[model samples]
Target: MNSAEKIIDRFGGQSALAGLIGKRQSTVGYWAKKGTVPVSWHGKLLEIAKNQAIDLQPVDFIPIDDEKNLLPAESSLPKATHWGELTIGEKEIPCYVLNTGDRVFSLKGVVVGLMGTDGGQLVEYLKVRALQPHLPSDLLPAENGEIPALFKFDTGGEGFTKYAVGIKIERFNELLRAYSSALLDHHLSAHDSTKIALTDRQLQIATTAVRFLQASSDVGLVALVDEATGYQYERAEDALRIKLKLYLEEDMRKWEKTFPDPLWNEFGRLTNWKGSVHHRPKYWGKLVMELIYGYLDADVAKWLKENAPKPIRGQSYHQWLSGQYGLKKLTEHIWMVIGMASACQTMPELRQRMAERYGRTQVQMTLYLPVQH
Candidate 1:
């Protein structure tokens, strides 16, 4: 028998278990039908099991293979191999890495961290009509009206079993996207009841979703997960090599005026250069190397410096960057540098700003000064 069925039988059948737990008999039946118990009821059941002298272990609550209509007696389920917490602002969520390489956050952590509500409430919210459209297809209720199956893991310790229920990292992003979309729809259709219904806690969740979406892209989220779980250190050494391949071109592109004139104009103003901004001093290249390119991964900067074709006259280092990902990142970095330069009144102020933003040690001002000829 599956875990849920065994538990029900131990409590002297579904009706007796329902009476002991103050839940409807159908609810107990549903648990048996799903081959797993809702985690919210675990504590009450465990306590009752203790009082009744029934043999109940935390591992008894691990979900069975409902897909095959069989117990996991012959084959073991996957377990968590790593654990960590992801902190965003003041809130922290417990995260895990399965032996299968899936990254997940506990369902309780997601709801409490993002929504400030009980995890069960989020499950209920997902069942509502307003959220169904925004939810991923896999997360939607079955056509027979059964709740979607949770992706449970064996957390490898009794204390950790309470946190075994989790959603994958990709699903977490999708959940955030859904919350964001629903919130947008609610705001746009304030008068329409058919749109998303936002309770105070759900509004909080939607706000968190908006902030998360604003701050991170798919790639940024992956890196955040890696950093949180310390998986970045365990990653294959070729990870950097693969990333560099994406950011650097194998061959130089046709030279274009990548750096805008405003960047140079602001640089001249901040540095107190008396020379014409149109004919920038050669030291401008050194400044670009330090402030702009220096913001990239140290190895990326080194690779660019050592391998890129030496700038021939009007050509520049940026021409060596791949047009797709590299140029996009470079453009964003350049604009941020220009913004910093525009904010500062003098060269030292600019240097301080760059140092603060990029975590660079203060450098000698003369390093960027023109030759005093």
Candidate 2:
């Protein structure tokens, strides 16, 4: 192992080191990538090491001569220009965009984050899992038992140099899919005697994989990384405006029955409204704002509230939504609300379900807004 790996291990892994030093796990990952901790952090790290009963020496931070010889001169390695954490549940995998525009994840971070296992075990896991007939043929390991090559990158600061291992973001995602598939297969075949028993760590990995795969596509993952690092704002100043345009129309469309009858029926049932569902109580408007629109992207929902036409004598807020993407999103959100309403027996129960499913929106909605004259 290199100095960086040794230091990380002695400190009880990347996450533990990060917690000890009062820094983000991604920052510790950054140090690991650079193959050395910053001088400023050295004192704190040593102090933490001593308290933790770790045998960390100051010289351990320096790269060994043999390791240096193995690496190409510093000039050959690409420099990271942008970097951020890809948070999946409690785990955060440090990711970076090179000056060359190539995106990659910290090699050790990816292994530790997804597998909750040792970074050194990744290659061997891939080799074993790749040979499984149940796994995809396109998995990371080759038929000859070779794994994908690790990328080296420079993450040095002024007047100093450091290097760390990385895997291309695409390869990282591929590994996630492979591991997810393997774990899921194991989960499904619980009765098989030949299969190794699933550990708690593997179960956690499986849960994380399902959540990540459900929410993020390859493009979405890139966008998430950009958002986390503030690179998206740098890339496009009007990104929110552009996104709002997709979810709101410049002009109101012809009024239609955008909301289904069952939605109001359920609302009426829950609220115990004696009046007809067709002529919903004025309070229903507030519920719509809270339950339906609240589920949207917070900024998009805010833009709609401020800019979209208010409910006039004849038209409602849904009528002002764009016919294409905006209406599609509205319809989807309505069904989700209706689904929750259908499942709950009481108002508090429905609210609890909503909180569990969507959480509370950060933007507060006014309960009563004057209808436009």
lDDT for each residue of candidate 1 in 1-373, tens digit (9 for 90 to 100): 6668978998999999999988899999988997777655665787899999987764566544344433243236567777655544333466778889988876666766666543344566676665568988877767665435455666654432332567887887888888888787768667876676766656776777777655446336656777999988966544443343333243443222457778899988988889998788888888887787667765455655664442445544454342333344556778888988888898778878888876667655655667898
**Could you estimate the TM-score for every candidate?**
0.41, 0.43
- Where model 2 places Cα greater than 4 Å from the true spot, the runs are 1-70, 117-120, 127-146, 187-200, 218-373
For candidate 1, the per-residue lDDT at 152 reads: 60
Best by the TM-score measure:
2
lDDT of each: 0.66, 0.63
Clashes of 1: 0
The total of clashing pairs for model 2 equals: 0
True-vs-predicted CA distance for residue 148, candidate 1, Å:
2.7
Candidate 1 segments exceeding 4 Å error: 1-75, 118-121, 142-146, 158-163, 191-197, 218-373
Position 105, candidate 1: lDDT: 79
Q: What are the root-mean-square deviations of the candidates from the true structure over C-alphas? A: 18.3, 16.4
